[model samples]
Target chain A: MRIETKTEKFDEPLHLESGRILESFELVYETYGELNEDKSNVIVICHALAGSHHAAGRYANEAKPGWWDKFIGDGKVIDTTKYFVICSNNIGSTFGSTNPLSIDPSTGKEYRFKFPILTISDVVRAQMKLYDRLGIEKAVAVIGGSMGGMQALCYSIEQPDFTDTVIAMATTAYTRPWAIAINKIAIESIRHDPAFKDGFYDPDDLQAQGLPGLAIGRMAGLIAYLSPELFNSKFGREYARTDGLYELFGRFEVERYLEYNSYSFPKVFDPLSYLYICKTMNIFDAGRNKDKLEDSFDKVKCNLHLISFKDDMLFFPEEMEEIRDIMIKLGKQDQITYKMVDSQSGHDSFLVEVEKFEDHVRDILKGK
Target chain B: MRIETKTEKFDEPLHLESGRILESFELVYETYGELNEDKSNVIVICHALAGSHHAAGRYANEAKPGWWDKFIGDGKVIDTTKYFVICSNNIGSTFGSTNPLSIDPSTGKEYRFKFPILTISDVVRAQMKLYDRLGIEKAVAVIGGSMGGMQALCYSIEQPDFTDTVIAMATTAYTRPWAIAINKIAIESIRHDPAFKDGFYDPDDLQAQGLPGLAIGRMAGLIAYLSPELFNSKFGREYARTDGLYELFGRFEVERYLEYNSYSFPKVFDPLSYLYICKTMNIFDAGRNKDKLEDSFDKVKCNLHLISFKDDMLFFPEEMEEIRDIMIKLGKQDQITYKMVDSQSGHDSFLVEVEKFEDHVRDILKGK
Candidate 1:
């Protein structure tokens, strides 16, 4: 499979949830397969935090496949053979999208902290614009997991009739306090780093000098993404050998794994973009101003499918169950389907348990 | 009950686990109530990580009581009325002990990273010396929780006949990989702080410049000390108001709580001391050089009482159950008692669920 990223510029001013306007922005997206004459086969795939528009296939210079390469190939679950799939980088992300690292056309400098805070709705609005540019009047489905799942839900509500189906996995309609606390700590870690310099550090020095803070934040996030059962089975009391001395500076295997992730993340992610994206996630609540959650769901006209992992500590199955019960109470049970994936990978199960996800996704796509 | 701290200097050298030796050292301890003539009614109360010799009562000019004031006063669970209590600051702690911040008698400067890494056994050895200085041949009991509980277990094994009873709470005989992983990340956070300067920062500038790293470490530790149920019940989705707006800089109540703890911790703790003590805890496997855990317990000459919290994520009840089963297999069940405290406070339940701990502790003290 081959993949190429393309960009589109929007000269129109876009209002943000922070009440500020982005004068003009650009979107980076990738498409798999061709759009049909009717465009009814179009499916928008949303990426999660730290993810990019490269959702499937590999670029010429890349060493690894795209983030969702396991599922979005020519014959995979979100098969390109039958569906025209579009995955775009979110506005506040550090990928090819217009993010804090991008230059401000008006100021002739990088936006950095000057970038307006984004909400889930703002991200959805940008992707909706991309849909319009491609002449996709209605999508067959909007599919995503975790933060991406939040965007899928927002797409269903923001453009009620544009998406015929919504597939959300390992996410909640409202961000919980537990998640907010974790995200706040992670952002604080980056802010406290002397190298961060209030998010105005030299772009060239950011990744090198701010690697420690970024890595620590990533390490904390990794712990939350994994389950105790997984950790126990994967690295239980296993010590790394250092110079044949396991007692001196040797660490547990899990520590080394976390260290590797923490170090490499800064190379690809902008610290300021990470803070902005996580803050957006912290404030994401579809029912923020509504009287009840049902009132917020009332705007979602698409048929809904919710999938939660049984071992996911972050987005628990109970939370998904609550959403199912709420939809049933709203007399929308006929339009809703809820399924739980029994996995040991915790919140990362959505990405790791390909077999379980594929079986359900294939059935849903077949309209069974 | 009145309590006072005292220090004893030893001119002789002390050997450490890292094959290093301190030329001279000092031990700081606090005593509550008078010791009996026979010295048989004495009980050594150990403090956990970041805790101090001030285990009970309020010091002059202080606004807050000791960490365990609720359970170690005149008529409290430890009962100073009946038993003489001694609480010593651990060897590698900043709380009036011979720690990294202590002045080296030879160099006339702080030890800093030059201080030898300590083991749980080394901490117990120092406390044992304190007992010898007080002319106590044997103690009625050695009681502690968390890291302190590790010390209590070490005391029972190192000097089996010196303590008649051991009460360890919310701890394990062997450090689990999960705990080692959390502690490693915490230490890494401190090491990443530029102000730390490889543990050689100016003493005067440490608390102010190195606070970010120390606070981040403390914040991470605080998360493990609490449980999900506790967070749900205490904070839920409650938001903190910022300038009458819950949207701009709004935070969860839990985030505010963690921020407060992170800010205040650096004021009293030495970042280097935190790293050393946490490392000591990470390597604190009572069964470390032994063929089996039972081999390590074979030396125990005292009755053992183990208490675990039902919700402790760090030291799971299953770990305690494993220890109990080992003792039963060794035919020492008659001398061992295991109890679980049903609480949602997680690892902190040993401190918060006072009534439950008190009941079990009092019964063990009464030899019931």
Candidate 2:
């Protein structure tokens, strides 16, 4: 299916959780299929870290489809033929959104480090305003995975009556200490790179010299997103070059794969945006003001579906089990459905193993 | 329990598997007790990556005891009272050994990258020469954990007639791809730091400007050494400062702990040594030339004991189980014993949870 992008500019400033305001911003988004007369057929799809507004289909000049192309087409699991699928780039994202890379109207220079820090709730609020402009009173469902899953949960809780259903995959309501620790190291890698220049380097020089730090950060993140079983099966101890044990630069296939990913990421993503999003993810807490997790979930009125991967080390399956148990204790077990998918993809199963949960996703959407 | 360090300089060139040679090198070691007649009670302990020759007691002005001081006291599990305990700093380590920080006699300058790349086997070979100089024909046992465990396994396989028992904990016969990937990123972090200057930076400047990269690398390594349960129990989501969510520099307790470790590690450790040792660890494979793992263990003549932690993500329990299963298939099960310790300390369990296996360690040592 062919896809077209659209943008809307909001002149009013956005009040952020950090008490800072984004003067004026633009939202880049894409729409698949037709919206019903009452706008009741709208299904909002949230993107994960490093993702964009392009949720599915191919553009005229693009070589590949969107990140979720496999599961969000006309006849796919999300089925654009039945519902209006809307995906917007989050405010702090680099992909055509009003991010740190955007020019500051006041100084006529890129925001960079001057950009205000954001939260997961702040990103959700920006999208909600976009929905209001598009005449969408409420979404049929919000579907997401990983960091996107965090946004879906935020929408369900903060905008309790805004969405009818919420589907979160491979994520937790609160940022885990283990996950935060890993992210902190990734951020430090970027900060320590001399070429980063405190996030003030020339845009052209950023990709060239700043790559070492960006690539290293991405490599660490990629390892966390994958399982040991997958790495062993795919790469093992195979050498990229064949001088054997004595070669200084002899590379493992796994190392080569990681390097390729690290090298390619900086070409498209902005470093400052990566840092901002990571900070937002680190501070996410559904029970920020509440004493108990159940108290936080008590305010979530949407029918909930939480799916976890068995081998996911970043967001363990036990966390989802705890969320389920909490809902049970609150006498709302009937309103939630929890499933653990047996997968070796780790936290990335939500994106890579879509076929494993195609029927379940279909059933959940059908209920809405 | 008052230990003293000793150095043995071997004038003869040491040959390495990497086809490089060290013209002359020194091995720094510590002894806890007297060597009995016939050297029948000698126990050689191999130190892990980044560890020093100081293995059991405290020095005159030292603020802390040795890394394994808790487990190697007079009446502890290893029982220094009954055994002569010797722990040597590996050649590539930053400690008082011939590492990259050592001056080259020919140039009067630090070897830096000019130093020969050493392997785990080379380190074991150097320790063997130390034993020869001490007039010890064989050791009662060789015990180590993590990289030390790798050295212990190498001692048993390569020097079958030299040791009677091998205690390998939180390690595998071969390096796993998952571990190599993590180490690859750690090395990249240091290399990307402009202050590193291709490993040619002055020592003073290195400690000042090169700290960011070193600290980030150490932080990444420290996270892998710990388990998720330990992080949650120890830190959770408590903030280091009380500005709540709005403060940009506000850190979680876990983040603060990692930062402290990263900062302090660079004070004594050398980055070049870290890179070299990590390289040695990444390329370690007992079955290097052999087609099957069982072939590698076929030459093993010493009784082997392999211990794995349930929470070790670096060296998963499955890897240790594979070693045991391979031995069982070779009908050498009688020569091998395997145990999986239940602990949330991850790979650090070998050092932190010594009490959990105190009796087992005592019994294994008594067997000799």
Among these predictions, the greatest DockQ belongs to 2
Candidate 2 C-alpha lDDT tens digits along B1-368: 75878899999888988777888999889999878877888888888886777888887798988988878879887778888999998998888889888989879988887887788899999998899999998888999998999999898889999987999989988888899988887787777777777788777776664467778888888889998999988888877875456544568888889988887777778888888888899888888843667777988899999989999978999988988888889899898999999988988998889888778878887756
User: Where does candidate 1 clash, by residue pair?
Assistant: none
Could you list the CA RMSD of all candidates, in the order they appear? Answer: 2.5, 1.8
> What global local distance difference test value does model 1 have?
0.82
Model 1: DockQ against the native?
0.47
Predicted complex 2: CAPRI docking category? medium
Question: TM-score of chain B, candidate 1?
Answer: 0.96
- TM-score for candidate 1, residues paired by index: 0.94
Per-residue lDDT value at B341 in model 1: 91
Q: Candidate 1 on B1-368: residue-level lDDT in tens? A: 75878998877777766677877778889999888888777888888997898888997799988888888988887888878999998888897789888988778988776677788988888777778878998888999999999998888788898887999988988777678767766777788788778778775786555478888888878888888778878877666765222132456677888888887888778888888888788778889843568898878878988999998978889888887887888888887889999988999998888887797788788841
Clashing pairs in 2: none
Interface Cα RMSD, each model: 2.7, 1.5
A1-368: candidate 2 lDDT, tens digit per residue: 43658999988889988888988999999988888888998888999987899989887798888888889988898887778999999998988989988989989999887888899989999998899899899889999998999988888778998987999989997887899998887787877676778888777886665467777888888989998999988888887875455544467888889988887888788888888888888898888743667778888888889999999978999987877887888888887999999988999899889998888989988756
